[model samples]
Target: MASATFPLLPSAGRRAGLILARRTEPHACRLSPRFSTTPRPPSVPPDVAGRRAFDLRDERGEDNSRAQSMGTLLSHAGLMPHRDGNEPLSPPIELATTYERPPDGNYLLEDGRGGGRVYSRTNNNTREALERAVAEMEVWNPTRRRPKRRVGEDRLSDGSTTPPMADSDTALPPPPALPVCASFSSGMAATSAVLLSLNAPVRVVLPDDIYHGIPTALHSVFRRHGVKWTAVDMTDTDGVKEALSLSVAEVEGTDGDVVLWLETPSNPLCKVTDIRALCELADQVRCGGGSDVDGGGGGSCGVNITTVVDSTWAPPPITQPLLLGADAVLHSATKYLGGHSDVLMGMVSASSATSSGRRLGAALREVQSAAGAVPSPFDAWLVLRGLRTLDVRIRRQCSNASALAEFLSSHPGAGRVHYPGLRSHPGREIAEGQMSGGLYGGMLSFEV
Candidate 1:
């Protein structure tokens, strides 16, 4: 369909199709056997790569089947999308009403032996396909820090003999497979889901200059649920220590749920946090004596803190936070994943944070279903539709921003330029340590 002319190819199948049409009176033609192109309902036609495929259908086939074809495509076409993949240039799939589930089919609203879907609200093919893809792609491996060399269990403090620190696991964990992905209505929806899941005090160690949404999300959502949050500045290592120490003392007997959220390349200002260092601090905070609770090394005394890093600023091939020891990676897929600034969405990826991030996924699923935060297939498709360009967009944004930053840095009216792409950025070293792609970013904010 991408090609306007389905001119019967030299292939025997095309020839046969045409021959059959000609042999039988156009009005008397019968339908052919059903054939599905992909295993998952989302798999699009081989020609459904680039453009929207709803309008385009095989001109040779019985047009009556277009409805079912549309359903299958709406649910699965967005899965393995190809940038250069051909498309028939069709209208999008928009099923106004729910369809009955086949005997073997699973329906979103259907609750049965397999929890089949019975209604569009309960579940839809599009949502299922998207959820599966998003879930699979969200899986990531969280990094763990190595323990500092210790002489013995007891330190020089009080001159007491210390025991040798134990090695938990020198090697890091492999990334986990993401099975479920949550698409939130707003940033608050995403944050609120994580905070309220735990029915206890929740500490949010945040940077001083944090995004307003984060604070509002934590306060309105968590506070209302009776959870507490504590903020932390990444600038001073000792500040992190002090905050954690005091926080621990406060949570004495009541196991408070402490979640430390970080925004690297600090929003609006391109400030970067050393994920490696943050993870280390989180470990030290979680482990009583700076030991490894995440298993990188034990006996050093560090608690296992649920360190969540917002990776929306940089997605895969650019930066992967779980690789740097972050317990979980959260994304405001809106900026980058959503690309055009058209769609608003958020995502949470798991690493070592909460049981391979599965529990978090499960909890999010509940919250999403309960709160109705899951994005529609169209929205998910739209968001993912932009993801294919994430790499290019970030690269170009980084280059362009760097150029602008340099201009601003030298401009007479400008006081300063804080762009991280510039080698002068203090956190550039840390940025280079964890970021997977371009040296710069697609966004930069400054004043005259």
Candidate 2:
């Protein structure tokens, strides 16, 4: 009997935008016509103790030398191995529902033999590629490779060029652990995974203008499991702080935990929340900084406070929540990430700042594997293909959205225009300071 192994990506170093596949020794399965003629790595790295499912390498060595621009990262994040030389330009879809299992009862073989990968629901090469692609986007530091803006692109009131909101000097550093993103069947499934992964008796502080699905889920399904939530104006940092303080006091002396749920450039309303400010507040509550009289009164000193941002409406290059200190960032890949409206997927990427935050990725992975709420391999491939054009698509979307918002605002029939890019927007100042390149986002709503 021959033993086989599947190596996805490396665990350490610059692991973004790399994919590898190998078959150890020869077996009857090797002759199957179902297998494509994908080139193999010249050699697979020795298996380390803590190696993970995905270990794609950026053979070009560009990922390790310098940070690439958002456009470049998106273009190559989910890069497949080359054809004959070793790496691929595009990903090959692996639609096998099940892989060969070992004759022995043990399925825990470190190598690919036996039941190492018994089911496709839990482990799929195509899906994991999508996860790695999105994870790269989430963790990429735009400050590392700031693109030079064109003339008259974003001038200030004083006729000076408006500096980028997130610059190299001011941007937050990368987290200790490499960011790990988990892909789910749908956006709601991704949201549910985050809530379920948390310790029970949880209280989620939700934004008043968030997508309706969140509140509906909390009230319908999650409430039965002791999951409670409260809605507040997230734009008002003070109001958000008050909500957290009260939530902690209410759950004091119990195993109750808190999650500050944020949806920036909120759905329908398009109101922007100060993600950095709220994340800092969550940290203060988690680390006991909010124990003073003005704070949460010591009850929140050691309480677990997780900050999650639902940036579905404002995807990357425009807003990177993890870099702004969020514990985890969620994306409804069904939208921008899958641009052509042909796929349904969701992603939740964990930040590596704190111990718990670092473990969050693995925790989400557990929930994903157990719950089996994962997207099909084909859907994952579609999203991966869509990622390559995300930067260009988003730029044009933002430009068109801004123009439409202006036209609506000027129309006498329109009552109110809701867009963070407009000066009339109340959160325009915070949005200007938080959003990169002065490009607000593609979503806007107006009252007629």
lDDT of 2 by residue, 179-269 (tens): 7789998999999999988877799899998899999999999999988889999978788888998887777678777888999889989
Worst window of 10 by summed lDDT in candidate 2: 49-58
Identify the leading candidate in terms of lDDT.
Answer: 2
Candidate 1 error regions (>4 Å): 1-77, 80-115, 118-122, 131-175, 290-304, 352-356
Candidate lDDT (C-alpha), each: 0.58, 0.77
lDDT score of residue 49 within candidate 1: 38
Each candidate: RMSD to true structure?
18.3, 19.3
CA lDDT of 391 in candidate 2? 93
Cα lDDT over the full model 1: 0.58
At residue 1, what lDDT does model 2 achieve? 48
